[model samples]
Target: MMPKKAENCISCAVKLTGTGFTRFPCPDCGEVIGRCAKCRGQSNPYKCPKCGFIGP
Candidate 1:
């Protein structure tokens, strides 16, 4: 069977799968960033440390 994995970060659109996984949207789940990659590194998603330059 195929294992299920996070596909997109609720904050940033960074692929929660392969290559993009290197970086994560929310360091952990249950959190939201309300941003995207192009806006930062990914898109329609968040990077990390929402308390940083990231947005609300």
Candidate 2:
């Protein structure tokens, strides 16, 4: 098996990767394990970068 790659990474835009500390999101907090261009980072006092919706 080989690693995956993006052909148009520069052209392609990702709103959020949703990859946090763990693969699964917090059941109570709804935290995700990913990167948000808007948020810069994930977790604690988290909010939706796309909509500014704060996490519970």
TM-score to native of every candidate shown: 0.21, 0.26
lDDT string, candidate 2, 28-49, tens digits: 5443333333434333354433
* Tens digits of lDDT, candidate 1, 1-56: 31233445445455554342333334454333433344445333334443344433
Question: Which residue pairs does candidate 2 place in steric collision?
Answer: 18-33, 18-34, 19-33, 19-34, 20-33, 20-34
Alpha-carbon shift of residue 7 in model 1 (angstroms):
0.8
Clashing residue pairs in all predictions, respectively, total 11, 6
Candidate 1, lDDT over the whole model: 0.40
Name the top lDDT candidate: 1
